[model samples]
Target: MNISVNSLNMPLLECFGSETRVRMIELLSRQPMNIKELADALQLSSAIITKHIQKLEENGIVGTESISGTRGRRKVCYLIPDSIVLQLKAPEPPEEHGGSGYAVSIPVGQYERCSVKPTCGLASENGVIGMVDDPRYFSDPEHVKAKHLWFASGFIEYRIPNYLVGRQTVTSFSLSLELCSEAPGYNEHWPSDITFSLGDTVLGTWTCPGDFGSTPGVHTPKWWKLGTQHGLLKTVTVDERGTYLDGVRLSGLTSADLAIGPGRELLFRIACPDTAEHPGGVSLFGRHFGNYDQEIEVRIGYE
Candidate 1:
C-alpha cells in the first residue's frame, strides 16, 4: 500500500512500532489463530497479546472473527493486508557540488525524434515494441515505453529540460548512458564511432569496442533470444574548458560553442551516422535491459 501521509492513516505506521507487534503480524500471516495461541507462540501473556491485537485491528492491519470452541467462543485473528510497501518521499539533493544543479532521467524509448536504418528495433521490459530492423516502428506510439533500442545508423534526439531562471547560469552539462555497438547477434570485436551533439554543435564521438553478448546482462529480460546483452557506461561532459568523454579530453568545443544559457533549448542527440569511420552500429540500454540498470542520465551544474 502507498504509505502516503496525506491519507492521515497513522495507525498502519504506528502498528509496526513494537517488535512484539511485528512478530504477532508475522505469526498471523501463516494462519489465523486465537489470542491464546499467539501468546503461546510468542511467550507473552494473554493480556499483552490482546493489547497488540487491538492496535493491529485498529490500524486495519489485522482482522478477527469469533468462532465456537470446545469450552466457549474464542477470537481468531488474521492479517488484513498481505503485504505492506512504504513509499517514502525522495531525499533532497545535498547542499554542495557548486550550488547543486538539475538532473533528469530520459528513458530509451522517449526520444523526441529519430531516424534509423535496419538492424533497428525497440522493446519494453516485457516484449519488443514492434518488428525488428524496421525503422517505421521507431515512430510507433508505444515507443515511449521502450526499455531497449538499437539501430545500424542515423540518430535519436531528446530535449533536456532547462530549469534555470533569472541570473542563474550553467557551469557544465553532462550525460551518462549505457551503450554499445549494434550487430545481428553479438560480436565483441565490432566497433562503432558514436557521436553526441547539442543542437547543431557536435560535442564529441566515442568509439564503442563491441556489442557485448558473451554473458547475459544482469537485468536483461529472459524472453529475448539472447542477443546483445549489455553496454559500457559512458559519460560526456562539456564545460568552459572543453568536452570530455569518461573524464578524458574529447574535443576542443566548449560550452560557448553549444550556446547554453538560462532559457536555451537543450536538444541532445545520439548519432551513429553512416559517414563515421567505424560505423558498426548503436545499441542503447535502459534500466530493465542493461547491466547498469539506468536510463540516459543528464545533469547540469550551475550557480
Candidate 2:
C-alpha cells in the first residue's frame, strides 16, 4: 500500500489519537495478519478489533485483501503507508526577495520508466511484491507501494514535475534518497559505482561501499529476513555553482547544463553504468522500509 499526503494538519492527528490504533499499526507493520490473528495477539474482542480496523482502513492507514480459506475467504490486513510527510505551504516571496520555491516528494516505486535486470525485485514493509529478479513483476499494479527495490544492473528514471519554474529562475535542484550496493545476498565490503543524471547531463558518480545487512535497519520490519535489510541515505545536489554529493563538490556541471525551462521536464536517472570498475549493484529505499523515514525528496530553489 502506498499513500502520499500534501499536509497533515488534522485528519492525521485524529487517526493516531487512539492507543489501540497505534498498537495495531505496530503489529501490522511487521507482517500481514487476519482480523482474528490481530484480535488474539492484542487480546481484544472481535467487535473492538473490527471497529479499529474499519477506522484505520477508512483513514488510509491500513489495507485489506481476501485470501482463500477453509470455508470461504479470509480478510488479511496490512499497513498501507511507508511514511507521511507534513509539507507546509511555501510562502510567496516578497518583492525584494525576487522569487519563491517549493519542494515535492515522490514515492520510490512511482518511477516513470525503468530497465531493471536479473537479481532485481521490489518489496513493501510487509512482504515481497512478486518473485525476486522477475522483471515482469515490475509492472505489477501493486508496485506503487514498494518501499524497497534492487537490481544487479540497469536504471530507474523519474520525471520531476516543474512547479512554478516559469515565473522564477531555478537556483538549485536536489534529490535526497536512500541507497546502497547490492549483492546476491548481503556483502559488507562490495563496491558499486552509482551514477546520477539530469536530462542528458551526467552529474557524476558515487561509489557505494557495499550491500548493508550486518544489522537491522532502523525502520526495517521485524519479519524481514536477516540477510536483506536497509540502505544508506544519500543526498545529491546541483546548483548554479556545481554538482555536489552531501555538500562536497563532485563536478563542475551547473544548473545551466541541465537546460531547465518552461514546459521542459526534468528527467532524473539512477544507473549502474556497465563500464564501471565495480558494477556491484544498487538498491533504493523508501520511507517505512529503510532507516530514513522519508521518501525521495526533490527540492527546487528559485531566485
Candidate 2's error at 148, in angstroms? 0.4
Residue 134 lDDT in candidate 2: 99
Cα RMSDs, all models: 16.6, 12.4
Query: 147-169 in candidate 2: lDDT tens per residue?
Result: 88898888898889876434455
Count clashes in each candidate, considering only residues at least 3 apart in sequence or on different chains: 0, 0
Question: What is residue 198's positional error in candidate 1, in angstroms?
Answer: 0.7
Q: List the residue pairs that clash in candidate 1.
A: none
TM-score of structure candidate 1: 0.67
Once fitted onto the true fold, the runs of candidate 1 whose alpha carbons sit more than 4 angstroms away are 1-100
Cα lDDT of model 1 by residue, 1-303, tens digit:
224343454656878779999899889888888999999999999999999888776554665666799999998887644345453664245334335586788998889999999888998999988898899999999999999999999999988988777777777888888888998898766789999988888888888767876556768899877488877767788888988876678888776666566788888899999999999889999999876668998888776
Instruction: List candidate 2 stretches off by more than 4 Å.
Output: 1-99, 165-167
Q: What lDDT score goes with residue 97 in model 1?
A: 36
Give the range of the ten consecutive residues with the poorest summed lDDT in model 2: 1-10
